[model samples]
Target: MVEADARIRLYEPSDDKLVKFSIGKASMEGLAVANQSACFHPFTLSAWVALSCIMIQLLDWWPKPEYGLLGYLPPLPAFGCWGAVMLYLIDWFNRPQFEDASMDLLRRPDVADIAKHYQRSPSSGFFILEYSGKFVGLIAIDASKDSQSQDTLMDKKKLSSSLPAKKSQGTSSVATIRHFYIDEPYRKAGIQEDLLAHAVQHAFKADSAVKEIKATTTSLIAYSQKCIRDAGFALEKPLGKLGVYGWKLDLVVLRRAYWEKQAAGTVL
Candidate 1:
């Protein structure tokens, strides 16, 4: 194992170069590849639609040959729509997802603005894991107040009914984990477990009102779910094909209580 002193710290604008390098490495590993479907993928479906429209426009304009209203009109709308759709699909596929959160972060044009967004409040912040003075991982947490956060909450309630009940006193503040990633070479070294533990501790410390930390991951990334579990979170239900997991601070307290009780009995 590569034994190096590792530390997790708040993100800084100066860390952009290390962050970008990490993203580039991930992209090369094909971790950012779009999910492919046997049946037409969404991008492929879009391309087909655009192509069909172009063909229809060509067929309509072919016989006319002259630069009249009909010939010009069909080509204009057809090519416009096709170009727009193609551009959209290109961007969509190119954008990284959860597995490559660091890449997604680096891709943003306004890194400073993004850094500010996460650091806007004590309850939210972005973090990077540095091992041996080299950044190797990153994770972020933010308050769940936006539309995406609301949607995730809704999914959790609807799908994770069977998950362990909250043992801690409930609060309105919910923190969502974002852009969690660890370098491949350094993984399986219990780094993720440590990172997650720190994340929860930081969340509780930063905002005492935060009672719960919520995370979601696709079934495809089994290691992510494992990391969450190793950090003392419980797997809830499946939200669509994604698995939902949560850690309640109250549960930690309860577990601690149980251990204390056992220790007291041993002393007696």
Candidate 2:
């Protein structure tokens, strides 16, 4: 009984020390909570293998001709557009959906609507950016075959140059980037730069003789402008209005520099 009483007394909380004892217990609880926190995702082995295959295929495309009708098709545009919608939803959940949001303010009604339309029409040339098996962003290219302005832009060099007649009449191999968006958290982690570097490298591997890859971005996209510039794309001109509504649509032209002075390359 005496030993039991002594042990009980030793373990008992005294009134005078109760506050300090509670604090110690709380500190331990806080540490326990912290230790239970989750970690950021890392890429898996299967993902790495899939990525390797994609890299091989992308590089292998360089030397071959882009087959007609199928070559330039943006795979699974519906899925890509939905992926973009998911990204926007993530953004909205984290931040306020401002009334003057760029999508709302621009020609598009809203980001979700724009994404839905693209999914249905499938011409926006959008692709999802997945990192560590998570959706990180979206990349889009403007490759509408009927875009006269883009066609004119691509053809301007050949039409205006005084180079050899054969070179002038040959192929006009070029492509334009239209949209690129990364989630806010993923913006500064060099993912954007890495993606572009990989993309450009893949393009080069596809065709050693392919010359250029260009893109246009609005000055309003300040963050994107910096990203594009950092990726070795240079600004060319301010884009004028889109249509006769005289609705002023201003954008900056960005071009990627490539040297392909070979005769085997054909333009799309």
Candidate 3:
């Protein structure tokens, strides 16, 4: 009887243990509202569907033919702005570096909640990830029109004093890689890689308009550099005094199409 019980225990693996954290699509609707913040964007399928219908109809019904496609599209700039919003939201949610225990000790849930609410109003859409059904880590991208221009996106005060300016504005929207972290035990696994994979994949699948996905990171964590590289990001030459000084999460820049193309190549 004891042997039989031991055999059964062997067959049944523990449930709470961390399993594979692979890259998967997040259902923006299932995102826990409490975790919403400027860094995390969550949208339901129904809301997305409704927004799409309204935008498509409005775009198809423009009165003036002079602007061509732009004229036909919805005059509501907010409605037309979702692509960039979704991109940043996902990026923020998957930011694993932000989830350090020291940072969490300083961060309060109430503050995070308030921030999330402001970020998820009808005008925006945020993206995030789920670990064991908990909002363990997240990445958010805001598509608001009032964002800063390239010359001053990452102020020196925020990071190393010597980093160079990394900015581009071919379009009106900007993509911010807002948040990233892995839960305690999950960090030991390859959750970071999975998170990055999903983020780049979603950026590519979401819109054709996305030109680049930008982020910052410290010189530390050689793994992070590798992760960005595996995802197809190229490192810019070190910035002036910034290279001499060290900081956490030095600002890094990556493109969606580049990583997506490489990811797709592997599947083939």
Taking all chains together, each candidate's TM-score versus the true structure is 0.50, 0.36, 0.40
Q: Runs in model 3 with CA error above 4 Å?
A: 1-125, 146-174, 221-225, 237-249, 266-268
Q: Tens digits of per-residue lDDT for model 2 on 159-178?
A: 65653323111112454454
* C-alpha lDDT of candidate 1 relative to the true structure: 0.55
Prediction 2 TM-score vs. true: 0.36
Candidate 3 residue 251 C-alpha distance from true site, Å: 3.2
Can you give the lDDT of residue 142 in candidate 1? 67
After best superposition, candidate 2 residue 265: deviation in angstroms? 24
Model 3 accuracy (lDDT, Cα): 0.41
Better of 2 and 3 by TM-score: 3
lDDT of 1 by residue, 26-112 (tens): 433332323323113555666666685767666774335486666546555565666666556644554434334444445442242
Tell me how far the alpha carbon of residue 151 in candidate 1 is from the true structure, in angstroms, after superposition.
10
Of the candidates numbered 1 and 3, which has the greater lDDT value?
Answer: 1
lDDT of each residue in 3-55, candidate 3, tens digit only: 31100010012211221121111221112221233223234334544676677
RMSD of each: 13.7, 31.4, 24.5
Error of 2 at 85 (Å): 32
**Candidate 2: which pairs clash?**
61-206, 62-205, 62-206, 62-207, 63-206
> By TM-score, highest first, what's the ranking?
1, 3, 2
